[model samples]
Target: MSEILHSPGVLALELSPGATPSSFTLGREAADALARHIADDLLRLLPAERDGAGADQADLLVLGALYDSVQLLHPGWPLFAGLSELAHHSQALAGAEGGRIVAFGSHAGAMPGDALQPLVSDPPSPLLLVPWTFSAPEALATDLGARMESVFMAKGEAGRATADFLMRTLGVRLEHARYLTRHDLCALICSQLEHAGYSALWQMLEFALLYPTRSGEASTARGQKLVFRDGAVHCALPVYADWAAAFGAGRSREERVTDYAGWLFELRQYVALLGAHGVAVRFDGDAGATSLPAQRLAEPDPSLPPPTLFSHEARGLGVVVISVAQIAPDRRVRLLAHAWPLDQAGFDVGLPQFAARYGASEQLVRLGGIELDATADDLAVTLPGPAMH
Candidate 1:
């Protein structure tokens, strides 16, 4: 904290146009703080200290963690100053003891050409990993011990903060786009759908974590499921993020509803990604329709209760949104969304043809009808081009 406050022109963070950091500024942080985290990771890899041999000597020996941390904070290129700083401190500390100054270089998959042509090293040391040398039994006990420590340490907020520090540092060290997982991608897509006018974006993360909700009514409490059947997929939002605020106190109703609007377009860009990958989407039927797999089960079947999700399909079932999550290997995925009604002319993905309906009968949801001011400006960012890589 003091270092960040005192340091001038310290690199802080980096992010895409609309993306937020994971817990912290991520790419932006003081170079030293980032270096410290790297140092800590290497320290963890050392054997348990019986006499502080590894502890005192490890910092004096390895500069891998610090340099790797820098790469993580600034991926695609390695900073010479940052690397030199680590090497200088480490070599000085070792002080002619023949202590090896092992430090990180261009990361795996990263090339010398990836960095600036001016980049140079004073004395180079290759990146290294701590080898697993413990016997099987010893390794198992160490694993269990670490797990136990995690459980007990989480009791303290300090532990949680430090744990997060380590986790985020290690996360970037593992891979470039390693922050996102299947579950997070679900939340990401679902959040975007919510930003859209599509309202069925509830409890979506629960589905990603516990996919294939075929276990009966008990699964309903967990929320909706993204289903694929007969060459089509179905999904419905079971809960809303604004509604989650009910459990806590913060925003007023208007503020909640207003800020709530951006959830969809935030992820709206993903819509085209789905389509580009040969996915077909349609919309039909009411979003609040009472349909579920339980519809086919016996009346009052105690074993099969109704889940919040819709099980079977019907015509005119208006779908709010459709999102997809890749299932690895070949990027195959299960489409998740509300029930979309099929049409001969394809998806009528809009409020309805007003000119054709002008002579016909259809109810328009007006501001007067809903008793809200329609004079408010429309606030939404149109989806940009697809950016899936």
Candidate 2:
């Protein structure tokens, strides 16, 4: 058995767009929230002073969910640099007992440019924009041991001040901070689930970590049996013995059938246990696929029509479409939104109509079998798409 270690604190900051004064105001509110949540913890928030100074009594410093005002003040500075400066300043303000600085920000479509372009060309600096994780700090402390000295970096400076302020107020460090890859994070999640007795989820998560799905192929076969392994866990339709084969192997047919039935009962129990913990299970044979057709509605037109409304073969069933579009130079659009089932005519016409209404192109390419409610937004939207390989 592996011993699992936990961190002293885990903090999350949400960075989105807002007005200049409003953004700053929101940052302050978020900082206060962090302070309240982690009261009695040594943390310091920043942007309380100019010239990038520190708060003297904090244990950890965080910065960002940066606003436009700060970015405008230092326009030429790379976004992460401003974030780092904010963290450094907060650290200086809070006379902390040498804890890690944690900053949180977006890694998705939040930025206008290539989201993958390094925020800083140099080594790991103060400003580190990291994906929001509900369990990052604990995982980091466990994985990186004592060398976890770190800061959160984000795509922009929009919410940097708020994040910095929050960390400054509520964060405490047991050691230095170190960054973890997305895969590492997922693995940590699996470990947590395993601890929580969600062994099935752990197995599925393990599968997802091992054999990540390709673009649009969220579920696939493992053999003659239709196996659904999403790099996380393995799920499948209930197995059925070929009746013809069973008849041919006539010796002790009843006993073999009884054994198969017993096995299936145990499998159902396993699936039920997963369900008890809010993990969803769907049998493959019972599941229906969402279909989006590919057809060029207009001739060489940049502004294409929307998809038509097709028939609702699977009405009342939830269907999520994951669309990945290349928006600009090195920038891509990954959208995951639920679509109510459509009648066949609606399927053929509704999407094109919607596209036409939205002034988007009508070239519809089908990426198959996305998770029922999963979207591109749920995961990171880096250029060249989500499969790391």
Indicate which candidate wins on TM-score.
Answer: 2
* TM-score for predicted model 2 compared with the true structure: 0.26
Lowest summed lDDT window (length 10), candidate 1? 1-10
lDDT of 1 by residue, 1-389 (tens): 11111101111121223332222212223223433443343234333355323311322221122221213222111233333343444323222122232333323423223432222223321221111111113333344234323432222121233345544654432211111212232444456546763333233223322342322111122222334322223433322332233321475545533333333222222233322222322222233322211111112222332112211211223222222111223332222222222221223432233112122122221111101113222111112134212
The positional error of residue 337 in candidate 2, measured at the CA in angstroms, is 24
Q: After TM-score superposition, what is the CA distance of residue 285 in candidate 2 from its true location, in Å? A: 18
Best by lDDT: 2
Return the lDDT, model 1, position 276.
28
Query: Per-residue lDDT tens digits of candidate 2, residues 231-292?
Result: 22234433233322332254354443343334334444445443332334444432233332
Instruction: Return the lDDT, model 1, position 198.
Output: 35
